[model samples]
Target: MSVPVAPTPGSAPGAPPGAAAPGGGAPGAPPGARPPLLSRGRWDGVTTALRSPAVLALAPLTLIIAVFFLVPIFGMTTIAFAVQTDDGGTRIGLDNFLDLSSHSRAMRNSVLISVVGSLIAAVAGSITAFCIAQIKSERLDSVVAVFSSVLANDGGAPLAFSFIVTLGNTGIIFGLLGLEAIGFTLYSWQGLVAMYQYFLIPTMIMVTLPTFVGLRKEWTEANTSLGGSRLTFWRRVGIPIATPALLGGWILLFGSAFATYASAAVLIGSGGFPLIPLSIDSLLGSGLGAGGQSTAMALGVTMVVIAVVVLFFFNRLQRRSARWLQ
Candidate 1:
């Protein structure tokens, strides 16, 4: 019916104004109208590309882990379960594990040593870290960090030898201060724990230093502004934020001490020490006994399982701690 409409501005030469485009909504379509297929396809392609960077970045690490870690673990697990025959043949069975049960004392000793040493390291390290954080000198912090890293990595034969010459019976401390007179011997489980502290405490300090440093002055000021005492601030705010990191560091220290071999072996020979690592060594070289490579592999497998669980909890705790740090 029949009013003539003026040609819409910028309309196609021969097309009516307000008409739909060839493949989509009208050029002047409402905001909610679907985009053209080409545009949509472009966005889909962009979304796909966005998902690829993380995968690509992680590819090398994943390949290395599969080849080194997973492959070794698979071989070890198979060996752990394989029984050796009198005729020098191997067959899949649980004989190694069954034999390992007899070494429960070694397991218990290892757990006790690791747990106690790590706990001591955790407390000592946390205190040290807290003190270090309070100091405003970046130079001092860097020095301490460098020393800690060096000491943490310093283990094995040289460390064992140093401990012996310095703390052993008739060693330097004994000669100078007569520490032996005090009935202290660097050859017992107590000595092992002491040796662990030389490394574990340094490790704990490194792990905890960052968390303590991240405790901003504003946070303390905020708590004080709320009429909280220093004690109250730590009780409510500081401890809560740092707890996850502390626990995670402690677990890491425990794992380190648990898996240690060379230092313990050198300081206290496998024949004397009943720790799992020492037991593994003894079993592996036993030659003509039930304690052989298979049993050693079984112990190794047990350690691997424990390490997996420890790492899982450590990662979870680290995630929680990271949230607060950020």
Candidate 2:
């Protein structure tokens, strides 16, 4: 059933295999004629992409993370169980865990600081989101949103320096206010809590802003029409619906504060009270100034475990809350 046309000019009979194709399009085509690729359908491109080696493009990034992130975690865990001999050789065992009293104190203080800061930030951020959502002017809301976005990720060494400039022992603001009569220490626990809120609130705002948009005003009106007080309605309905996003935001803030090193390291210094991160940096970097490296490694493993556990709960909260928010 094959009807034969004359062989193409460049694809003559008995030609070499790759010399040209029968259509004279791919390997060779008539002058001024369309190329084979232009004649192909859209599905061909999709199929080509699917079959391409480009799918493994992220392999390098994945390999880098495995080497840098997971390797260090595993190394830290291994070192926690290792001991140094008098002759300078290292042996591995459970000796580090045996004396975890000071480590426990540092872990507890770090958790306390992170939790308190995150909660304060989440509450403040939620209220700000609500206020922003209720704004009459879109321009104002946009400006505030842009400002919050900038502040959210600005908690680096510069932020710590700014705080120091504004509130340190010999701070400019303190001098202007003439508050030398009342004593204040910027390196104290309270100062850390306040400094944490500066960044954490913005983090919370970004995280929970979507939830504000998800909130339906009709639900509030309906609750009011049903004779429920605003407080009662918010406590029973609004808070329940928003719990997932709130908790998720709080967890984000907590993780950021917990892993903070530069700010604490810069402002508070190693001489400050042993927050877990500070302790780790001091023990390992300062060669156990008043602590051991194995202990620091053990604290690091403890943080990894805590992060995993908290994220597990945050994910569950998200799934539950997404039922309404989505």
Candidate 3:
């Protein structure tokens, strides 16, 4: 005779103790059966509800970028490729790029200026940051922090004017020092780099300060205990830890210097120096010649390419540094 199975626990009265409920006739079916796919107790529904609001909020940002940023970039790319007609229509071609090669000097000058200025700023800023972070006095640290904060926000036209007033011929500083008639001009490419550094140094210091704080003092002490000189410690330990942040800050500084227009424009005048951004402004406005516009766009493209390469190297450095730290 077959063994009788008891009804499953919690089943209706008179059902065998091990028998399944009305849903099925198997023993212990309730615990062993698959759970309901959309059970209210499951985490999937809760997670979906929690994430839905965030997804909804991001929709506006997505729409804004699509409409404003991507659309304009597409239009600029189109303009960079097409030849402009006298009647306002563009004859689509590669003439724009072809014209860029003719003004290679300006391109080279801008790249050289940005690279040199950024490297100088990075080195100066890193040293300043290292010094400030290593200091033991709270008051001095607060003062430096305030200075960095002020300079970081101080850019654009006002900064340009300030530099002009300080270094420009016939300005107060130059005039009082009798440098104006001595053939000193702070309105050249070198002058622009100097002005850029005023802001770049402070900005880089801010970027690098946090990295300095994150550095453990133990490394320096350990190196000293091992008879390593200060220079040796810095070369072997300090730089490796800080190199990623240093390089990243430099990349940002370079990008900032590359894109700056108003400062250079105010100091040097539009035609005197032809940095890419300055050139672009002139091309879009009074310098609306075909060659000017094409060359300006090409220079803009070049600046972006340089920025990309710098950022890529910086990120690789960061990853390597992080691994080393670990």
Candidate 4:
């Protein structure tokens, strides 16, 4: 007399309920012991996607940039080259680019402010960042860091407004120093440089503080043990290791000043400063509106290109600068 065998859960479906799966497990292997290859692959993929710290951290930023920054860059670049046909149909052409050359003075001024302001800011801010990095008191460091954060973002209207009050003719600082007697005004190129440094310094400081803090004391001690003076160590090891960070901060400041609109606009309102942002705003507002829209878009596209270039520089610098630090 024989009884029929039942296949176990791990067996082939067609096998007896309690019988072994001939191609796979034994007579009574646990159902959960090993999933099929396809199922395992899917689970592994899901777990990897979930557990990756880099993906988790960058996902939100990537989404935001894709939606906001990249989409707008495409739209703006399209508008820059768009031309209206006789029947009002739009097509891409070089008319806007030809006209963009007419904005040379504004371009020159924008670059001038950005370059000069960045240099001053990078130098001044690095000095301040070095000082901040050296403070042994965590509380004092926190307070200074808070102040730097406030100033770095204290751009636009508030900054311009404060400068106006202090640097304007009737304001307290101006009245006290009588800057007007020596012929000073906050509406000219020189004044704009000063005004731009207000934000640029803090921006540089914010970017540079980390580099200063990352400089290891052991390296300096090693340099000194090698018979290098403090000045020699700084001039050679310290500065060489830090050049990338400083240069990155400078480029950042330049981009900030170049794209700045509100502060410059407010400070030089109706003063005919040939800044790119002001020209764009004016073109959008004045009787030139219809004719200059494309040119304004062209300027915008230029700014986007510049910003992307700066970002590329920072990334490349980080990779290469690692060797110097090591």
Candidate 5:
């Protein structure tokens, strides 16, 4: 059923590939034609990507992070390295990092407080989550979630002021109840940890609640049906499943407590307790103390590094926990 077909004028018989046709165009093309500058498919792909829902949704957040977080971090890192000169100038140097030796006590205090507070919050929060799981009321669960959310976000000046009113000198507990007889004070190291607990425990609860609540009742029931005791069920299944979340929550709490400055600033107010955050504040805020602004920035940079490390481990543990939870 073959029919005689006429060849295009430009595509003549025995024509060489890519040879110019009669009207100054490539073979098989019309006269005076040009190739496309960009591939239509590639352009369409780019257009589709621009119109993607995920990209559009993330645009604002990406801009905000770039402007606020990344930009400031870059500026801070630059300032951290830019050592002040005696001639009232700046030079790129490690003077600030070297000056960190003077603040060893602050470093030690920061590590101690963050570690102890996070550990305590982890244990206490786990217990609280378990207790909360025992409650079957949906309303109570919602209430706890809301309460934990609110308290987890609670800190800074208001929290400090509340603590001051409740525990500071001339306040209710110490002033009226005479609890000061036991040598209790809100401005001490122990009190700082207590203040950290005010929020960290709730943060832990927020992190652990889902895991605890979502624990499959059937697993425990099967264990019990298999002649296992309640304690044995928990000892084998509960602890193993919950441990990752607990560790991740602990690391998160550690970072939170480590970076905390507002509440501590208001409550301690340049007190004897030399925390890393407080030290940075003092060094930078006090007209550049012996360590100077660069030193404060260095401390800030150190915190950023520690936070990054903590977040890395936390994410890994969260992934591990997610597997078990799922």
Candidate 6:
């Protein structure tokens, strides 16, 4: 017998030679060989394309922030430094800031009003929130909700006008009480604080309500089971948990009060209680060129600074409370 010819390992026996492998590649790839379908760079590109949905989704929000928030802030900051010339040219400097700071009475009044108003709102809000949460009556809760909704949206010139009618010299309350002859004036700082509280209380309640709702029923039950008094329970469990909401609400209230102008303008009747906003308005209306605009901007900047500082502390307090709650 002739020596058996060794069949080619990859070829069909007694059939055509040099037939391609089914996969069009060698049976076993080399240790470091890349797949023919997708190299590393191409794979990376595919992955990047797949991730583009996130980018697309974020684009609209990014555009909105850039256009509305960031642009306005940048423009205002720029104007704060610019000095306006007779020919409408601008020279950038710190003169505007100096002028704003020099208006000490306005700055002082603004600070005081904001602080007092915020504090009052915070206290009232916290109390209202606590009471609403603890109360079992649905009708009362509904009333509170409706009341808050009305007050929170009440702002600007219309709100000022409303307050003027409600709390002004000829206000319904004073008229009903027949106290006009007794010289009841809602145009004072005290009246402003009270008017601010009308809205502030509702805002505070809304802000703090969630915090109250978040309180564990078990905590209250356990406290009561342990014979802890209501006051003790509040001190030990309630305040700590709600501190963040309370502080945050207060900061928000302060910021709102700081920026308020229409209400102050309407109630105080101009020049009598020149808060920072009023001062800014006067400067802008004075036709004092870029200097006035810059000064007004600087005052705005100061208000922003105050708000930021309050917000920072409030945030810190919130974090601490969260940690304690956890």
Candidate of highest TM-score: 5
Q: Runs in model 6 with CA error above 4 Å?
A: 1-68, 82-93, 137-150, 178-183, 288-290, 319-326
User: Please, what is the whole-model Cα lDDT of each candidate in the order they appear?
Assistant: 0.80, 0.72, 0.70, 0.75, 0.80, 0.72
Tell me model 5's lDDT, rounded to 2 decimals: 0.80
Q: Which tens-of-lDDT digit does each residue in 1-326 have in candidate 2?
A: 01111223222323333333424334345644546565553223333333334423534565677778877877888888887778998888677777677567777778788888888888899898877776646686667778778888766788789888887878898678765666666787666777888878877777676667666778888889999999987798888988888888788788887887778778888875678888878778867544387888887887777788778877787778778875
Q: Kindly state the number of residue pairs that clash in model 2.
A: 1
User: Which candidate would rank higher by TM-score, 3 or 5?
Assistant: 5
Model 3 agreement with the true structure over 229-295: per-residue lDDT tens digits: 9999879988878888788888888877877777777776677766767666776675765467665
Q: Name model 2 segments beyond 4 Å from true.
A: 1-56, 83-93, 136-146, 178-182, 224-232, 288-291
Per-residue alpha-carbon lDDT of candidate 5 for residues 13-56, written as tens digits (9 for 90 to 100): 23332332333333344556653436342233334444555446
Which runs in model 5 stand beyond 4 Å of their true positions?
Answer: 1-64, 82-95, 288-291
Q: TM-score each candidate.
A: 0.75, 0.72, 0.71, 0.74, 0.77, 0.71
lDDT of 2 at 189: 68
Candidate 1 clash pair list: none
**Global CA lDDT computed for model 1:** 0.80
Ten-residue stretch with the least lDDT total in model 4? 1-10
* Candidates 1 and 3 compared by lDDT, better number: 1
lDDT of 4 by residue, 17-109 (tens): 323232333324355464354554324433343444544565676677777877777787898989878998999997887787888988898
For model 5, what is the error of residue 41's alpha carbon versus the real structure, in angstroms, after optimal superposition? 15
Q: Report the C-alpha lDDT of model 1 over 1-326, residue by residue, as the tens digit.
A: 01111111113233322232333333444555655657643234333333455434555676777778877888889989988789999888888889877899999899999999999999999999989999967887888889898888866877788888888886886579787777788898777888899999999988888889888889999999999999998999999999999999999999989988889999989667699989888887887565587788899999988898888988999899989888
- Tell me the lDDT of model 5 at 57: 63
What overall lDDT, based on C-alpha atoms, would model 6 receive against the true structure?
Answer: 0.72
TM-score of predicted structure 1: 0.75
